[model samples]
Target: MRGLLTVCSAVLVTVLTVAGPVPAAKAAEPGGGDIGEALRHVPGLTVVDEAPAPDGYRFFRLTFTQPADHRDPDAGTFEQRFTLLHKDFSAPTVAYTSGYNVSAAPNRSEPTRIVGGNQLSMEYRYFTPSRPRQENWADQLTIWQAAADEHRAVQAFRALYPGKWLATGGSKGGMTATYFRRFFPHDVDGTIPYVAPNDVIDEIDSYNRFLSRVGDDPGCRTALKAIQRDTLKRRDEFGGLATADAAKKGYTFTTVGSLDKSLEIAVIDAYFAFWQYQKQSDCATVPKAGAPAAEVYAWFEKVESLTTYADQALAPYVPYYYQAAVQLGSPEAYDGYLRDLLRYPGADVPESFVPKSIERPPFDHFAMPDIDFWVRTQGRRLLFVYGSNDPWGAEPFRLGPGSRDSYRYFVPGGNHGANVAQLPPDEAAAATATIRRWAGLPPAGPEVTARSAPAGFPDFDADPIMTARPRL
Candidate 1:
């Protein structure tokens, strides 16, 4: 396994120097204009509000109307909400693309915090207010269309924030950032995708291997698998507990068809979720052998709740599932170990989880192959972060030794939330030094501070609303 040194500071700097010449910046277009003047004439763009932000900064909330399907621009459009955190027109800019609903409020991204530059946070298409009034799942939810949407935003903003621009996001958002770069190579100067995966199969086999051995101790692994087996063996008793709990929480699993199926899926998801979010220390919470069925179920609930698969929890993410079924493949449940105990052995099938209202188009298996080739061969000025134990890290982009101006960093024993900031001081210094040099800034120090997150910011790791297990 590649260790933390792969992304350590010195290695990154060396890669940058040895990699081919940094791509030259595109020539600035004629008629340079301010942000407000630039937006006034752009089609489908309107600056709705501007207000003071933290750290003496200011921001603007804008709505961008983009075609539902980029291939057919005249077909229809949807309003994608975005926020612009202003520093200076001449300062570096970070384009933060989110993979889910764009929060109505303003926020700062990790890149912006490190670079101390302006930020543009764009919401993903077909999510929340970004969704078209008339939903068209067939042609509208493809990653290509979403990338085109971000391309438009970058094009519009380039005329305003004429300085350096970088793109970034976390998890699915991180995946979106890389897709944006792949589809629109010249849209931004660089990209930093955190905990992103390039899933190549409908049922990613790597996750199964990852779950087989994650924590430091073998007993913890044995205990976790035993708990899963016990839960499935006593699913009837556990199902009743789950059903009553779902009622109290007002969650329904109609998307999966029945409460029993929901409970089974929850049990299947627990093993993955445990390692995905929890630290090695958390393995102590796994129930021991012969633990009461209710206690085992409660531990399951604590680690991965049945409510995660509820109708309301899954409603906003229907578009994601559609994309997964079509082009963005998802991980299949690792049920091989517990196959004997599972009542519905096929519950982990990708299509089985998708809602009936949405059609599952034929997956273009070649899509990921093409993307992988592009990212591995031609990708430049890109940095990747992944946790050593993150199951999704199993399929990270393979950055060859000969690859240039690109680097991948693995947090030793880190989970999905790993990043440069979370690295040890020496490693963080090394990684940030590379980022600072890339962003055309001076050496890093106390001057860089992350802006406060908006109120009610959803915790992606633990919050059920934000937890959608992507195979990637």
Candidate 2:
């Protein structure tokens, strides 16, 4: 949620006035020609840079003008940035809706590779380059508004790619795909939302319920809770270490109060994070009770970054937190067990993390319910992939009796990183075949070759994707 600047200037002199004024070059118009040329002509769209791509493909970074409020063009406009991975005009297209700022560079999504189609990876509004200059974050940022941005961007490019289209994303992005379909069903032929949650309220109970008994190994769960309790019991020690690291790294903790509170927050989040990313077998690595203080802290640090709540880390995700607070509700804190050990009792809740600078708007209870209703009753050609153990998957989207041509698959023992590719052999084949059929392509054979994702492609469900390289 940061920076970008647009500039313009005029120069005039007595001597230069002798020549007749020249009209500004007319913008390109979409016509029968190369995709690049056609893209340059798309109204309100600008091609920022073209980068290297795999063979048979072309890549270009783009920005599109979008209204701050889709309901009112007079509300002003901002540039929403996105990247296009082009193969052939005739090939299908995957409109990849990033729930946050996209990668710094262009990359292919798994669906793009699987469908062998062009990819349009769009950064969500209020995220860096796509962030609006206006300071009205609360009113401008909503699931519906973000969906409108996607709708316009996709339609803007639809002329060039008349072939079938699919919308896909992971985690929050998966939620975006679902929301986009809810808002504009005709915009894409199908949607594949990976590990997406349908949190219809600010504090969904399913999250805590799921985290309480997620994995098969009760020992692992016990160990994780012990770790939480140990960390909170010795918050000062772990907080001191985290504080030192933050000071050395210039990480600020004002967003979530102080390093002390953040440490407690991390401890509370440890259980959810552990199950979200770690496998049941990995539980043995969790330091059991009575382990050395250093051992506990090290493992805690491994499960969740010490700087996770730092200002530097949280600033980029303020918009996300805001969205969660007001519209897309996040999981409620599962701190009932640690209530006794808690130093900052209620400060660890998700709503508590919204940037202190802005006034938190009341949660729009109807927004998510509306989308959920649409998904269940009217949604078609929707494919959902979720991890059985993922806390976010606790309340997976359920198709209604009236819904048609929609499917949901849960990967056995999968974490948040679940996807169609991760399903069992038969399930994977069925998912792939469904995707192909939706995209108007042929059914898959025994072995369907999916292209490797580009180096810049993100593992949207993974935490390291952020810890290693926080998006702007």
lDDT winner: 2
Model 2 RMSD in angstroms? 9.7
Judging by TM-score against the true structure, name the best candidate: 2
lDDT of each: 0.72, 0.75
lDDT of 1 by residue, 331-365 (tens): 76877888877777877655666789777768876
Model 1 misplacement above 4 A = 1-42, 201-204, 290-298, 446-472
TM-score of 2: 0.89
Model 2 C-alpha lDDT per residue in residues 1-472, reported as the tens digit of each score: 0011001001111212232112222333332357777776677888988887667777898888888876565668888888888888878999986587766454666677677788888889987878777767767788767877887777777777888999998888899999888777788999999888887555446888788788898888888888788777777777778878898989987778788877778777778888787787888899877788778778866777756788887877778778777877777778998899887887765566677778877877667766676677678999999989888898888898757899999989998777777788888888898899989998866345343354455443443333231211
- TM-score of each predicted structure versus truth: 0.86, 0.89
Instruction: Give me the overall lDDT of model 2.
Output: 0.75
lDDT of 1 at 54: 60
Against the true structure, candidate 1 reaches a TM-score of 0.86
Give the clash total for candidate 1. 0
Worst 10 residues of 1 by lDDT: 15-24
